[model samples]
Target: MTAPEPGTDGQSVRPRMAQHYSVAPEPDAPEGYVAPGMPGAPVAGYDPAPDPAEPSAGRRRRRRRRRTGLAVAVSATAMLVGALAYGAALSRVQSSIGWLAIALAAAVAWPLGRIGGQNRTLPPLGALLSATGLLLGQLLGQTLRLHRLEGTPYGELLGDALRIWRADRHPVDLAFYGIALIGGFLLTRRTASTD
Candidate 1:
């Protein structure tokens, strides 16, 4: 019980025990001198060290991409099959009549395909062009059918169809709706993968 060492309020003073008896200074490194085996460190002329794991990284990346693509493709195909079944269920409405809906769907699909094809290495322009051609072909087919069905010419056919669909509430197949939805999903996934 010697006199308490002073702290802020004159408490007993005591030296804190040092954990280390002594400390050594780090070796002084010369300018640009790097220790051996350190990353980016120069040894003599600084030859590039080969990455031992690069090939494995690349393989794993490719495998991941393949799996993703396979999953997406399978899902899309399954959806397409389900949509076809819905179309079949509506078979009574005269699928010949329903081709109009198909045509409209194609028209919408082409521009979307064009957008999807942007800057692709081989340029998916071929797919876009096919979509456009299919849409136009559908239009022509409708025009021909219009002449056969209602004594209308190719010129006045579009106006008549518009009037019919607009005035008469024809039942639309939910499958086309499904196609459009799935197509959008496929487009987004494909774009993201490319990036």
Candidate 2:
């Protein structure tokens, strides 16, 4: 085959080689071939030459995938550990406190799921605020339910606080706080991908 001559337009009209579309070189070993990494041995697809950039690109992709996997593994491990610790603590609590704690945990997880869905980053302050708000919401919800069931006036106070909270941007505040967790996860993933 004749090599195409370079032209002013920077296009070569040479026929394409089948190797261009093949993942591996022909099975027949070429004589005197030596792979860079395999030194002195006939490497599977050793050509006397190869693009230096190809190896680097592969390495980069592998590194990025490694980091992502590591992050996911660590996140899962942390969740499991925290759940176990909380369960142990919960078992030792009084029934009332246990139920309250379970309610609060459920509330906290809801916002956490939202944050994950949004894929946002959360700073430490935001984490603290959201956790506190979730716990408070659960506590208030339980208190209101209990008082209302007993047909007492205390339920009215909860209703008022809820109204004031709703009117005074409590929902917005909680949303802002929850956003942090999403942000944290997103930022971490972004960094991992780039690695």
Candidate 3:
């Protein structure tokens, strides 16, 4: 420690000791030297400065959109798989297995609804998706049946399938389709509630 020096006014002044003590660093401090509690100072191996290589806002938004697009694509693929299974099952059996379509719609809608609920902004896309799946499954089953019975060509099955379904459509089938649409919409929608 240095001795106090006499001042011109008869008072003693303490020697400057900031360099030897734990204090805020000067603006011109050497690289890698940081004083405690200073902004941008590293603490516990953490750095506060933003990295130059970090993505910009637009890049981040694009990345998020890509991820969301990928998720929707995967969901659509799953819906197609479910529709194929429903059609195959119905074609092989003599009894009506239409109820399975309803179940599949609900199952697909549930996840979409849950995901939409979390966002609080996107409307549950599940209803439209599930309805499309139901229609596709029914069309597929009708096509398979027509091919088996009337020897419809593989290439023309889709058009013939649509024609047969239109000719043989029943009130009960419409009711089932309406029920599935309503159910899918309900499953995907989330209502806000007060605590």
Candidate 4:
């Protein structure tokens, strides 16, 4: 049979066929461009970029923030309630208790944030509401006190209470507002990126 096909050592060579069961590569792509994550070995100087959509095993997922409207509403409500509570307390105590109001406003911010389901925005809103509430509460207390005076006419106390802010001698009133503002600021401090 044509000299029986010369063998490697001058003997007859075997006639077995070659076999390949692995996945076939695309005919169009060049031989060197191997896809990532494949069993094929990685080629040098061609590291594939990590996919943005891929879920990394090493990193934590980021949490999205809550809406703003709910935050503001909750903060305002907390501030108002805190101020009213402080004012009512102040009226009974009947003294320059600005510090107490400041403390109350500051304390209310955390709960306000919690109510809004957000770490951001609510604290400042709460502080603002608290300060305003405190101021209003002070005016209310003043008006109530003036209502008890001997010759004060009805509805005149409002004007008198408004005028109190202008009085030069009433340092305590100014201090109340100032402390309220400062205290609000101090309470709403953001320690981390979350808030």
Best by lDDT: 3
Across 1-195, the per-residue lDDT of candidate 2 in tens digits comes to 867697778877666555554466555667776656775766666576657756666686676555444434444444344444443443344232322333333333333333332223322322343345444543454445445556678646666646644554545545533553444333333332212
Best first by TM-score, ranked: 3, 4, 1, 2
Deviating ranges (above 4 Å) for candidate 1: 1-93, 96-142, 167-171, 191-195
Among all windows of 10 consecutive residues in model 1, the one with the lowest summed lDDT is 121-130
lDDT, candidate 3, equals 0.67
| Residue 174 accuracy (lDDT) in model 3 | 72
Q: Which residue pairs come into collision in candidate 2?
A: 120-182, 120-183, 121-182, 121-183, 121-184, 122-180, 122-183, 122-184
How many steric overlaps does candidate 2 have?
8
> How many backbone clashes can be found in candidate 3?
0
Q: Model 1: what TM-score?
A: 0.31
Native-referenced Cα lDDT, model 4: 0.61
Candidate number of the best TM-score? 3
Model 1, 1-195: lDDT tens per residue?
775558886654676655564676666988777688877666687656657865565786676555544544443343344334333333334343433343333333333333333233212322332233333333444445556678866578877654543454434533433444444434533443332
lDDT of 3 by residue, 1-195 (tens): 876778998776865554564775558868887688878666797656766799767886676556445545655776788889878776777666666756866666655544333333222455667777878888888878777888868678898788877887777777777666776666556421111
Task: Give per-residue CA lDDT, model 4, range 1-195, as digits (tens).
Answer: 554678779765767567585986556877686677767868679858878997454443232233345545655666667766765665577566777776666655555544344455555666576678777777766666666654587487688866763462376767777777666655654321343
Candidate 4 Cα misplacement greater than 4 A, ranges? 1-67, 117-123, 150-156, 190-195
Q: How high is the lDDT of residue 33 in model 2?
A: 66
Q: Please provide TM-scores, in order, for all candidate models, with all chains considered together.
A: 0.31, 0.27, 0.57, 0.52
Off by over 4 Å in 2: 1-55, 95-195
Tell me the spans in candidate 3 whose CA falls farther than 4 Å from its real position: 1-67, 114-124, 190-195
